[model samples]
Structures are given as structure tokens and as C-alpha cells.
Target: MSKAAFTSDSLESTFLAYTRVLSQYREYWDFLPFAQFDSGWSEPKVAHAMAQLTETDIEHFERDATALYQQMVVLFPEVKMLPVPELRTQTRPEVPFWLHTGIGGRKLTQIQAFVATLPTHATHSPQHENVLEWCAGKGYLGRFLAFTRNSCVTSVEIEARLCEQGLAAAQKFSLSQRFLRANVLSESATIPFSMNDRAVALHACGGLHTTLMTESVAHAIQAVHIAPCCYHLHGEGQYRPMSHVGRANDLGLSREALKFSVQGMVTGGDRIARLRQQELSWRLSYDSWRQVHTKDHLYRPLPSAPKSLFQGDFATFAQWAAQQHGLTIADTEQWQPYLAQGHKLSVQVRRIELIRHVFRRVLETWLVLDRALYLHEAGYKVQVELFCDYQVTPRNMMIHAHYLS
Candidate 1:
């Protein structure tokens, strides 16, 4: 409920608070739901209460994280004292009428909100006269910025076709924009960032955004505006904290743990939910059957199958999955019992995930705040805000920083 923007000290305090709470309550969110059958609750009353959770309760928690948190507070009285910081919302951007051709409704809205949330052209110093758009897809955001601002935009993208399309659009509008087709991760990609450049990335994946941050700081870029996504997509196998504070309070985030941060169900509707449920149920069923056949209780992860596979019966999906692991489904195998068992396991997993899902945003906040603290440590005035509603995109949080030195 606090409207005050996060300063360096405040950001550190909030980050530390989340770290402490997560560390304290690691039992709830620190494990994979499918990997373990046990509820793992130490409190007898809390365990009894959670064990009684029905499908409806799981569905409710799936939709609303705050509701789950409130319920958790009621169940575990000690967690009521946990310090949870609320991110301040930014003013909604006014979307001007422009030829927003080919852009989807969701994407256009995200671009508008992102652009308006940034500092205006008048607010930029002479050093921030130029803009570098990292991983720009067709340079839509860069083109929009060029249309609205006086800054020359350099859009960097890995794909040549996208760069060509973006370049064509920029040329058509006679905007001060150009596209560079180069892998931002490659050491020899030859990016043209300078001290006068203000780096901007919209929904850049893990390594891409991290590259922008490191490159910007190294080049002494005047400013950086980034909304990062896909925390698990980084090239590095494990997470390495960027800021000193984060390193000091390291949660030892694994790839699976990072993936858990983005498993929120905000935009997906009933069909998506149904598909997800079917997929999980089938996968769990296969795992259950495999455990008995091999006499091994350890969890074995299956490679991701196509949506078409889920459309078929569990028998078909299991056969396909089994083939990949050099196993065969015997003709006499009773799939119905395993399927029933899978459904039961599915419910159990979902109930366990209900409590774990509450920390998705908290983990996300820790991530972005770590980036902000890194900028703060590098002598930048950093600010983090929710640029749009969670419904628009769960990855709506933005970090804006400018060199003060």
C-alpha cells in the first residue's frame, strides 16, 4: 500500500526482508511439488488444514496470490509478522493514436506503458541523446520511440529478417532509427554502444538483459531502462547474484527455482488451465508407472512434449514418453489404475503448489531488485516500479536508472 518509490537503502531493506522471509519459510516453497509426495508441514494443525484443501481451494489460490498469503497468515500465525513490501504502481500511460500495424493488442499496450513510464526526452541529459534497444523484435519499441522522441535509436536484434523489417519501417517513416543484426551475447558481435547511449530493453530474456546491464555499466552509458523476463533462460547454468547485498544474502537459486518464479497464472484462461492440468496429470501418471516398474522412487523428468500429445489419451502420451527413455509399455499394463493414480497425484501436487506459488512475485522482486541494487552500487540513481497491471503481464516490473556521477 506504500506509494513511495524505492530508494537504494529502501530497496536493500525490502530485498533483505524478502530474503529473511524466504529463508525462514523455505520449507513451503523450496521443493518441487511433483518430486515429493509428502506435504512437509511441521505444524500438526497447519498440516491437517492443508491436507483438507480441495480442488476449489487450489483453483482459488492459483488465481490470487494475495488470497493465498492471507490464508497462510491465518493458518500460520507467525508468518503474520513477515515484512512484505508492496511495489508502487506507475501512472498508466496514455496511448496515442498511431499506425500500430501488425502489433498485437497486448504487445502494443506493453510498449505504450513501458515508453510512458520512462523519463521524457526533456529529462535526458546530452549524454543520453542516443538510445540502444537490446534484443529489439522488429524494433517496434525503438520505432515508436523514434516517432515520439528526438533521440536516434539503434535497435539490436539477432535475426536478420526482423532487422530488415524494422529497418524498412524506420526508413518508411524517415525516423532516426537503424537495426543491427548481431548476437548480443557474442564477444565479437561488435555492438556500437557508447557513453552517450541510453540502453533500453523491453522484456529481454535472462542473458540478454544481463548483457545490457554489464555492457551499459562498462561503457558508462548515461541511463538504462529494462524490463527483464525468462529468468531461467540465462546461459549460465546457475544464478550468480549481481549486487553485493544479493551475494551476501544469496538464496542459492537453482534453474528449477528460477523457473518457479514465473509459473504464475494471470493471463491464461480456462482452456489453458485445462490443457496444463491434463499435461501434468499425464506426466505424473507416467512417472508413477515408471517408479513401480523400475522399483525406483526417484523422480525422473520427461522432456517437453508437444500440445498435440496432450490432446491424445494418457496411453498414447505414456508410450511416446516411454520410448524416449528406452522403456516400453507392456500389452498387459493396466493404464486405468495408473491414470487414476496420476489424477490423485495431480491433485496432491496442485495443493502443494498453492502455498509455493505465493512466493512467485517475491522471487521476481528479489531478482529485479538485485539488478537495481547493482546499478545503485555503480553510482546510479535507480528506481523500480510496476509499469502495468499484473493482468497485462506478470513481467511488468521495470528498472530505470541513470548515472549520477
Candidate 2:
């Protein structure tokens, strides 16, 4: 079958773009990446550069945030011009009211989007005998498949509670679904697959989704639908590319750099945005304070704190950080200039990251392409596309691979 136009140049160009910015701002982004300025003002040179950021520059940075984002879109245009595929229109099955009893709104919407898109992807593949939901959380996606699609469903999840919950829900609905408790990372987690098995996974983080792709080939499963997320969660420090093409192009992504790929938050509401900014400001301030007394400009990642800390003034937050680190900062005023520097650095970080955002999706596609190309190399026909709008989830790219006789 002739596939719609999807090309490697997009990922290649984006990866090149990502490499350029990463190289250009290696020190700046590595230390002050993500607008959090992970490194405190310990390096005199780095601090010196930030200290020179005038108030006018900060105001300009703030004003141009939206414009910079628009410029990013123009620079790296989306190339996944996917042809509209056929979707299941038979009926929307009754979503058991109990199924959503404890699920939050965001999770529910994600589930909805996953279920809505699954059928369209599944239809494009050769008909298979069963559905295997990888890293299935309460088997929500598999449950929808079992009830709507005429297939036996097997849900695999590590959590016993989720297994129990999914099993109970399946029985209540009288659907053909079963839950398997297995640590996906273990050797024993391989699902017994036949060519008749079709698998699906939604937002499987890092190596979890990659494992599914490899297992599908190892077992010769007929089809797979996977949307990967949380690239930073991989056990390895650097991303090991999959396909030969992906491997050939040395767009090495470190764990810290991987965080930038999924850091775009254009869809969040104003309040969520403010809270995020506030959180980063306090954390940056803490870094600034630590740099002065401890003489360590290293970026120290703090543990989870009460929301009250973020609610408090910078002075109180600095004291909390000092106390937490067993350092007695007798005079917080001395660190005031450092805190001011941190804020200035945040503005600079934001502006630098706007350029990084241009390459975010394209780099993601390159990674996704590596996974797809790996599947293709393993003898499965693969298709990759944006499964939903960014509003639904920024990590919305889906990879569908099918094996035909």
C-alpha cells in the first residue's frame, strides 16, 4: 500500500537544528536550561554574563515570548501531512460510570484521546486476534477495545491494585479482558505473542515503549500502536538511537537535553503557567543563595517541598534552602544580588529555550522515526504521525507497525 507523504528530512533537519542550539548554548542551557538556571551563579563568567542583563532586556524577553514561539513554528514547519484515515463510526460504547470513579479530568481526557485514536490506527493494520495493552494502567485503552472491537484483550500492568481494578471492571462489563501482573522491565515480562496478537500502548515512557517494539519483533506480533512519552525517564544517561539511519546520524541526546524535548507548555492555562514560573523562580533563587554561602555553584536538585514554600517570600525560601542544606546563612541580604541575578538569568533562559522549542517536535519525530525505523528493520511496515493536537498532549506522536504475510 502506498503510504501518505512522511519524510526523514524533517527529523534530520530538526535534529541538526537541535544540535546547533545545544552546541551554541551548551554552557548557558546546561547551566541555565529550562528557565530554571539549574546552576547557581558560581561560575564567575556565567554570573557575569547574566549580571549584564538589563531591565529593558528582561522586559523585551517577556514581550517577545509569544513572538519567539511563532518564529519557531515558521523556522521548523511540521511535515507530517497525514492523510485522514478511516475511523470507527459504528458506535461509542458505554464507558462504565465506575471506570471513571477516581480518574482525574486530565487522565480522563488522555484516555478519551487514546481510545478515539486507537481504532483509526488499528483499522489500518491487518486484522489480529487479540489486543495486548503494554504498561496498561487500569487497562482503560484495552477495556475500550474489548467492549467495542471484537477482540480478546490482555492488559499488562505492574501495579497489583490496577490489575485488580481492571480485572473487576472487565468482569463488571462482561468483556473479554484479562489483566496480567508483570514488571515490564524484567525478562519474564515478554508476552507470549502469535501473529494474531495486536498490541497498543499510550504514552509509554522511555524504554518501556522501546521494549514493546523489540518484543513485537521478537515474538512476531502482527501489529503495534505506541505513543512514547517522558524521554528523560530512560535508565541510560544518553539516548541510544534505534534504526541504522537514527544511529548513523549522531544527534546524541543527553538526559538533561531530553527534558527540553517535552518542555513546551503552550497549552497550559494562565494559572498553571504562573505557578510554574513561580516554582522555577523560587528554585533559581535557592540556587543563587546556595552559591554565596556554600561556595558551590553546582545545581543542587531539591526534594519536593510544601506549596507553602513557594507561597512565601524569596527571603524565607532562601532560609529554608539554607536550613535544609545544614548551612547557616546569617545574612540573607548578602545573597540579594545573587537572587536578582537568578531572576535575570531566568529571562535569558526563557529566550534561549524559545529557540530550542523550534526543534522540539522535529527532534521527537527523529526519535520516533528511529523507533519506527527499528520496527521497519525488524520486518514490520511502520507509519508515524501526530495522533492528536498539542492541546490534548504535547507528546502526541504515535507509531503504528504492522506485519503482513
Candidate 3:
């Protein structure tokens, strides 16, 4: 794999490149690093290279994925080049004070970035007269589009509470916006999409966004603008490809693999980071201890613990976790070494994950391209590009498509 920019290539060519490379090395990024302590590298030299990484090296790799990815080219030359596109950001619109009122800083930023790519009130043509905001939470996006674009807006959301709030806000603002409460996934859900409507969704997760495209295609809607998130939240645990090329290639994406694609997003502040590290250390220690006693040598998932569990130390958390799983722990005195061992394992796991993290964007690109190619196959002219800067949101890939006619 030499350096090749997929952005300059055709969708089919880019898809083929990713498929060939990913198929060749499916063993690397397709598995969970935390599930087992084994690095699973066939080459002893690769294993030795990983073992040589210190905590500082691990931290550096985790923080800067690009640097790590470039370094990985030395070991895995087959993946020397990737088909990741250079993402482009849309020019943001000047939002009114009224529009910015209740929205959080991040949400407002994302909404502005998303809305910027859409047709404004002055630019709305006869073919794209109305707006349909799918999975509208409180209809903030719908209201923004209605006010800025002056389109007849229909905000469809599952939650009655959000619909009511959105309706109230629309009325207060005197905007031509209506909120409809209906589940997008339900067969009986009435969607008010007309041929002249341009459907938009900011960050509809998994099947929610998929449903948007399916419904839009079925109704022959004028256009669709969407930024998809949460690739693993599909109703079915597995990801079947949408395009003919994708279906033919058949990447065999499990739910775990889908989840792995989006796991590289930045976490919250220092407190959250510390708490996460603490939890990881405890969980790994327990797994290591359990494997020794039970001789199963497999990862056993524990139920999500309460935040309050973290206020106490590792031993207390382990006790609660063990009781939940019908397992017993050794004496508290014996736990000290295991706690240290867990920390050591945590560093090792993080190092292992650094290699896997390089493919995070690659997997996401494949998924996004699958959707884009699906639209293209359905007689639509589709453009897949970044709607916002990656710093604002890693899930910034937007699919903007319109009927070929």
C-alpha cells in the first residue's frame, strides 16, 4: 500500500482500495484489545516492539494517533497507505441571538456547522421548498432551519416531551415549524415527507440515520443532509453493508467491530479521565484474578456499575463486581499485588489498542462510503464530506445527496 489519496479517486476505486487493504489485514483491527492480554501478533519481533513501549510511549501514542499510525508503517508495511480523505469543514452561518439562547455550546456549534451546508431561505428553490428534520430532539435543528432558511419545517421525533417543547418554541418564535411525535423505526409512524422536502439530521445514531435515508429514498424526497453517529447502535447486532459493492465485498462487521470504529473520540476533562483509568485498572485486575482462579482465561463482562462505586477504592469495587457475577475474591492483603498487576495490564492493553486505534477512522470511512455509494446506486448524486472540523466532533462526516433528475 503506497501513499494514495482516496479523495482524488472515484468512490468505487476508493472503496476497492479500502476493501483490499482491510481484507488483507482483517486480523489486526477486527478484535477487541481489552478482551484478552494477548497482543495476537504472529511475528515475535512485532510483539517485542510492543513490549518495548513504555508508559510514556503508550500515552504519546494514545494522544496522537497520527504519529502512532506513521510509526506502525514500519512494522505493518501492508497498511502503509490508508484511504482516509482529508475532511473539509463547511462555512458556518451567522446565528442569531434568539437561535443561540437555550442550546449548549457544543450542540449549538454542531447545529450551526450542520445547518451551514443547507440551503438558506434566499437560496431555497421550488424543488426544495420544505425541511424535514429527522430524529429531532427538542427540534432545535428544525427551528434553526425554519428561522434561517424560512422553509416549511416538520420536526419528527419519538419523544412526546421533545415534540411538545419544540412546538412551544416554534410558536414562541413565530416560525413556520411543526413537531410530530412518532418513532422513526415503527412501521406505523407517519412521516410528513413530500417530494419537495429536503430532509436533514444532525447526528442521528445508527439505524435512526439509516432509516432517514431509506424513507427519503422511498418517498423520492428532493434531498437529504445527514451526519451519522453511533455505528454500533443498529437494532440488529451485526452491520450488513448497504451498497451493492459493500454487500459484495462483505466486510463481516460484528457489533464489537462497529463499536471499535468510534471508540477513539476524546473523553471529558481530567476528572473523567482519572475516573475512567481507575475503573479500567479495577476491571482488568478483577479479570486477571478471575482467570487465574476459574482457569477460563476469557473476558467476562460485568454489568455497568454505578458512579458511586468509584468513590471507594479498587477492593470495594471488586467486591461489588464479584458479588454481582457470583464470584469470590481472595483476602484484601493479597489484592495489593493484583492491583499493581492490573495497572501494568492496563498500560499493556492501551499500547495494544494504539495499533487498533489507527484503523478507527478507516472503519468509519468504509461505513460512510457504503451509505454514500448506496445513495449513488439509488439514482441520487451523493457527496460525502466532513460537515465540521474533527475537533468539534469526530462524527462530522456528512452525506448530502439529491435525486439525479
lDDT of 3 by residue, 1-405 (tens): 442323313777787777887777676688865775677777677788888888788766766666887877577665565545545545677767986688998888888888887655574545436888889999888887877777788988989999998898899889889987888898424777763469998889999999888888888887898899998998875799989999999899999999988887337666776677778788888877877778887788788898778778778888888897798876743787778888988877776777677667778888988888888888788777776777788897888887877
Supply the global lDDT for candidate 2. Answer: 0.65
Q: Return the number of clashes found in candidate 2.
A: 0
Per-residue lDDT tens digits for candidate 2, residues 1-405, read 113333333434434444454444444334335435434534465455435656465434344544444433443233222121122222334576765666677666666666665544343245535888889989877876776565688888999999999999889878788988988879543565552368889988888888888778888888888889888787867888877766776567788767766776343565655665677767777777777667886778676778777776877777787777887767626656776777765665654455445445545655676777778777777666666655566777777777854
> Per-candidate TM vs. native?
0.88, 0.74, 0.89
Q: Could you tell me which 10 consecutive residues in candidate 2 have the lowest summed lDDT?
A: 79-88
Compare candidates 2 and 3 on TM-score and give the better one.
3
Considering lDDT, which of the candidate structures 2 and 3 is the better prediction for this target?
3
Per-model C-alpha lDDT, please? 0.80, 0.65, 0.78
* Candidate 3, superposed: residue stretches over 4 Å from native: 1-9, 43-49, 64-80, 119-128, 187-189, 329-333
Candidate 1 residue pairs in backbone clash: none
Q: What TM-score number comes out for model 2?
A: 0.74
User: For model 3, how many clashes?
Assistant: 0
The count of residue-pair clashes in candidate 1 stands at: 0
